[model samples]
Target: MTKKIEVLGSGCARCKQTTKVMEMAVKELGIDAVVEKVEDINEIVNRGVMATPAVAINGKIVFSGKIPSLEEAKALLSKS
Candidate 1:
């Protein structure tokens, strides 16, 4: 299945960085996935994310509150 990856934040630098990290991880891992940026506060809240720079994989949160390292993101995607 194609992995649905979301980086949720307020479009800040951290959020952008997190998105880039996820994209790079996806590229390096060579997996079928898509990285999306979720900046709407309502959507973030709806997802139950209380922090910025959160990562959701296949509609389930896997990381939050900070930018994940490349290795961490790769591992997360691998699991998805």
Candidate 2:
């Protein structure tokens, strides 16, 4: 199954970096994943995230506020 990963933020550098990190993690792990950037503030807030650069996998948040490590992201993706 393809994992659905989303980076939620206001299209800031940190948000972009989060997406890139997730991409690299998936590539390195050879996992089938779909990564997306969500710049919608409403959506981000609705998810109970008070900070940018939050990561969601399969509709459940795995990380927020800070950039996650490759290993952390890969683990989240694996669950999806």
Candidate 3:
């Protein structure tokens, strides 16, 4: 199944970097998935994310507060 991956933030540098890392991880893993960025604060708050540069997979928030490394992203994807 194609994974639904979302990077949530305020469109800051860290958020952008997180998005890039996620996309790279996806490409490297060759996983069937989609990487998307969510900049809406309302949505982010509703998701209960108290930090920027958060990642949500399959509607569940997996990582937050900072940009994750490529290995971390890959590991997160692998588990999801």
Instruction: Please list the C-alpha lDDT of all candidates, in the order they appear.
Output: 0.93, 0.88, 0.97
Please give, for residues 1-80, the per-residue lDDT of candidate 3 as tens digits: 89999999999999999999999999999999999999999999999999899999999999999999999999999999
Residue-wise C-alpha lDDT for candidate 2, range 1-80, written one tens digit per residue: 78888899999888888899999999998987889999999989989999779999988888898988888888877766
lDDT of 1 by residue, 10-64 (tens): 9999999999999999999889898999999999999899988899999999999
Return whichever of 2 and 3 wins on TM-score.
3
Candidate of highest TM-score: 3
Candidate rank order under TM-score: 3, 1, 2
Segments of candidate 3 deviating more than 4 angstroms = none
Residue 44 lDDT in candidate 2: 90
Minimal lDDT window, size 10, model 2: 71-80
Q: In candidate 1, how many Å is residue 60 off?
A: 0.3
